[model samples]
Target: MSSDTQQGRFEGKIALVTGAGSGMGAAVARQMAAEGARVVVLADVNGEAAAAVAKELSVGRAVPLDVADGAAVDAAVEDVVREHGRLDVLVHAAGVDDPEAKQLIADALVEGRPPEVTDRLGDSAWRRVMRINLDGTFHVLRAAVRVMRPVRAGAIVVIGSSCVFDTPVGYPHYAASKAGVHALSQAVAKEVIASGIRVNVVAPGPTETGMAARTPDVLRGGFADPRVRPYATPEEIADIALFLASDSAANLVGAVLLANGGRFTA
Candidate 1:
């Protein structure tokens, strides 16, 4: 670990990070580039954001992608592998919470209202969250596995949410999607272990991202607790992700490495 960390950890590796336009996804892509990845595919639904990030990286290519689009995901994966020969690492961070649903949940938290208030989530909100979070993850995983399987070597890191553990009442869809992610990652890990492909999840608590800022102050204030201190920066989450993607975590397949700031006891 020291040898690589001191000398470009991912040197020569070809890495792809979904949701690389902003937040945790963008941070992971930048970290990989700095660590020496030969090329970092910065994929995001927002083309402008992705391009901005790619422009800043020494080794990066921006690709507009909506993870929910299976064909797009497959095409992107195919292009990356074709151009680079192999994809050594994949980071899936593209996801979303229905704005209405998210705000309703946060309001419930701020007002100290009963959790049942979130039961009003409409069909569209539920579907939107599910499509982006769960189905999107499936699309990326399917595409990545198709290529990495034959090569018999690759690493995958799925961005999950700590909210899945305790189950918050207001955002059932968000919780459900993340829970599905954890299950999917574990199941895929077991199925692909023989192929030497590793799959893992990194569940972060409240992060210092634009999304977190929009949430209720009551929720973001958790960062003020002495025990939790400061909110986690995107880079902090990326560090854990890079560790799981690196050989240092060789034996840590099918694991959920929670990076929450101790907000929940379980």
Candidate 2:
């Protein structure tokens, strides 16, 4: 959507973007369409939202999918290939965070009290996060690999969190889930590179998205620094994802590119 976007970079490529209903996923889908992707399948749990976003693309369609359901994930990827002939790119952006838990921690931080979010975390909450974030990523990535391995040509950019590098307080489950995604991506990247498939991770920090908007101001304030903006835009993050999924990053395999402004240096 910018002048610097490489026109036709994805010409003849078919892309599948999870969490495409909103946030960074939608942004990636939009950019892929702009860059001439043959077809961009917008898959999300929120079917209506995904459909709304798909209406904006020339060759985009909505596919209702809950990535937590491994069987459904496999079916969705198989359907995409069956419909489009080949799967050239995949951007796994579907993930979850406990905003209520984060707010509780932020309250404690503001009140000068020790944050004990994990102690209060229930088994259901923890499992829900892991199911959607870690397990969901595994399912989607595995599905993509199945389709791409035979073709010996494809790119995958999984959306991880900067928390993998610097774990944030009150986000134990979220951080752990993203860490799993990061590790899984590297392991699979090594296994698939020989097959001509490149798998990479984008670890983004505080970005302007629905999730970030839900975060308390007290917590967001911690990210404020004169050196860089407090938050990156979804479109900005999408640019990084799109680059990784394109030939521009052909040599980058198992690389975790951080897009957290200047929050973390490692």
Candidate 3:
């Protein structure tokens, strides 16, 4: 008889995943664990969901976190470092959505161009989008750097979007936020090499998660070319993230690794 224990490639590293309550974050956390990471801290704005994911992963370190809150972000980093003694992997998956901008994106897809913004594009919409998608990733990266730089060893995988390139029919704000993520990864990869900390972006497209189902229909069918299918699963994208987090991608700093099944390439 063969043993069926799932083994990890990460074997003994400590990882922290934000937005681990669901979607790609949860998937990434599970994959990291399976690949041999000894410890995983699941952090989410929704404490119960985070805890559940931690339990599902069978790890005990689930935490409540609001990535938009700088103090909370800092504390979470400190807690992970203090408890784990060192940090080896960081995954930023926490984020928010903008239905208004999404509508614009979808309209552009269905109508072939964005409808005129006759004053309905609220300032609040822009700020909230930046607050979570952009600012949230910033806070996590900044806090992780403080700890990882000290050890002179770490890898950060930011969850970005295909929209940055394909401009997914809706969610312009999401696309813009992801574009900022790509730029930040490139800048930090340069800034952190001296400290032996690497930063990279993994932009996944049309993953088959709850979030995908909620995506604007125009956005979903936008990749309508018969030759290319855009849909992916969280587990599928997680495998890519696992490689990026592992030693295999040691030289892959500042890379915008795409895992979109040839949607844009085609």
Candidate 4:
């Protein structure tokens, strides 16, 4: 636990975090537990990974989930509510960046070849990214909303990408998916606020995570500039996410907070 943790900030809160197997999702779970959440359900596609992180928490449980599967997502959320009685917080962070496509573009750039990544993009690649990144978000968000609506009290913080604003040449599909997430979050926020649910987005840029680790050196060279920091740590992003999920951000709803370390000011 960090010294700065709000100590019991989330006491008695029941929280659910998707993608909790690693990266920002795992960080959020840890912090929520440290802050005294009653229970933090860690859901991920990788059951073992989620269970590993669950062991680190005082009140954590692991649930294997494929966010792309709407039925499974709904069941998972329903199960949490049924077991815990109520859900107070939701952090939807499960997503993909399509490392294979990125690698292809990187190789082309290195070899001085036309990197027509989009032109060569097959249906499988495009659909896979959309299914996991965009469709999965919808599945999770909708499920959370269904339960939270009746309770008339909840907080949702979605992990979006700065790529949505400043398009990345290597990841059109990722950018598009995140854009949909941002828009969906805002729209849903408006609908749910009257019912006492708060929804917001954290759009981060080049975070240091497993996803970023897979990025080729050719594409990661920009981070080498000494004038600017390379990437935000998972903890840093988690801090913002927790803030949105906490009472501290009560005034925030449908807001997209960008954590790009000044990488994109606009």
Candidate 5:
């Protein structure tokens, strides 16, 4: 489906993608296969969904996993290693969004808010958001690097949101966590360069995916801007993912590449 596949850069390489059931995760899984990866590990909480995507590609296997569960993540990594012999690539693409819950938290951020109105920053909803996006990311990376380090080679590409910069007023927790991701990725890249592992992040802006389709109607109308007519397709974002996964970006490490479509001026 891509020139990458025809070129066969990933002909014998194996890749593991988290949240491969839907959204950017599914897109990336497909793209990785297209690039000729002999084996791919599709990991997601939704086992059936992951299997379906992996089945569509037909060059990979799926494993139901929750990145939030460290033990589960560890076991899944082991499974991939057992089956593939080594892990060369890891992509973190699963995440969740709840604008309403986030808006409530943002409201509390307003000064003079009643003490009774606790902030969502530390609430259950916020905790879950951070747990999945932040803690889960860390958990997956820890496990991936463990396998990658010994091999003295690997590439980690994480899916981040462009919202981290031009973020809406609501999701402070999500933004903060993603911000932490970029910083941590840079720090980890520096720490692991000597180990022969590379870490980088891709920030996709307003991608056309299941996640965008499910965004509330109120949110959809905001896309009517004439200057920003079309949303970037998941495949376009996957192009960046593939480049990051390949030797094209071999010199890249601790880099945060933004793929947002002029949503915010640099």
Candidate 6:
């Protein structure tokens, strides 16, 4: 958990993690709870999954939410604030990234085959991806800022994609959505900085999550090429997210921290 055994960085704090059912989100929630957060809300679209994760953490509470709905997002935030009294840390991790579909596209490209029109960044796929990744980020960010700005102190860590930098082929929709997220984060960071609220992003490359597990072996090998390196564990991504949310990054605002192994360089 970030290798900072010093603990208490988040003691007495309240953290809300969207997509806390699994992957990097769950890892962040666990790490924060270990660091002494008084409360951690596990917000996810999958209520059962969220409940399962919450059952493992003493301070965890599962809240089912769909970030695409503005009203639902607002209500969810209100519930957290009412129960916890304050939201010191927020990790936005809920977004759509269908590994199976992504892997198919990658495999086709590698084999010099033309992807099916319907499956290759079609209008339907584009809209679905954008609604979840782009629109969802907007909904949650707006809801959080409304509550946090008044308090004059809060931290928001957005989970973006390394696709913004790598810009790989076959997944135009995914890359576009994540790039939009980075832009949104930067703009919001500037708008909220004066209010004592910090907003930053974490752009992670392929990691050992359900999303990446569906990739073909050949494609995975390319990702692990000597220069690019192999996939990272969810824990590694969680560590970076924690660091950005912690006071250690007080001087940083609107920064996109990369946790993509060696996929992108300085």
- What tens digits encode model 4's per-residue C-alpha lDDT throughout 1-266? 34588999999999999999999999999999999999999999999999999999979999999999999999999999899998899999999888788888889889888667888788999999899998999998899899999979999999998888888776788889899999999999999999999999999988888988888998888567677777889999999999999999999999999898887675
Instruction: Tally clashing residue pairs in candidate 4.
Output: 0
In model 3, the worst 10-residue window by lDDT is: 1-10
- How high is the CA lDDT of each candidate model? 0.88, 0.93, 0.81, 0.92, 0.81, 0.87
What lDDT tens digits, residue by residue, belong to model 5 across residues 1-266?
34545457777888999999987888888888877888888999999999999889878799999888999999999888998799998888977776565345444445435322235345887788788888888888899899999989999998887878875665677787788777777888899989999999998877888777766654555665778646888778878877887888999998889998776753
Which parts of model 5 have CA positions greater than 4 angstroms off? 1-6, 102-122
Error of 5 at 142 (Å): 0.4
Indicate the TM-score of model 1. Answer: 0.94
Candidate with top lDDT is 2
What is candidate 6's lDDT per residue for 24-117, written digit by digit as tens? 8889888988888899999999989899999998999999988888899999999989987978899999988756466676767777896543
Model 4 residue 32 lDDT score: 96
Query: In candidate 2, what are the lDDT values of residues 134-199, reduced to their tens digit?
Result: 999999989999999998999999999999888877789988999999999999999999999999
Error of 5 at 147 (Å): 0.6
Q: In candidate 1, how many Å is residue 38 off?
A: 0.3
Give the better candidate number (5 or 6) by TM-score. Answer: 6
lDDT (tens digit, per residue) of candidate 1 on 97-147 = 655665665677777886554457778878888899999999999999999
The clash numbers for all candidates, in the given order, read 0, 0, 9, 0, 0, 0
Candidate 5 collision pairs: none
**In terms of lDDT, which candidate is stronger, 4 or 6?**
4
TM per candidate: 0.94, 0.98, 0.90, 0.97, 0.90, 0.93
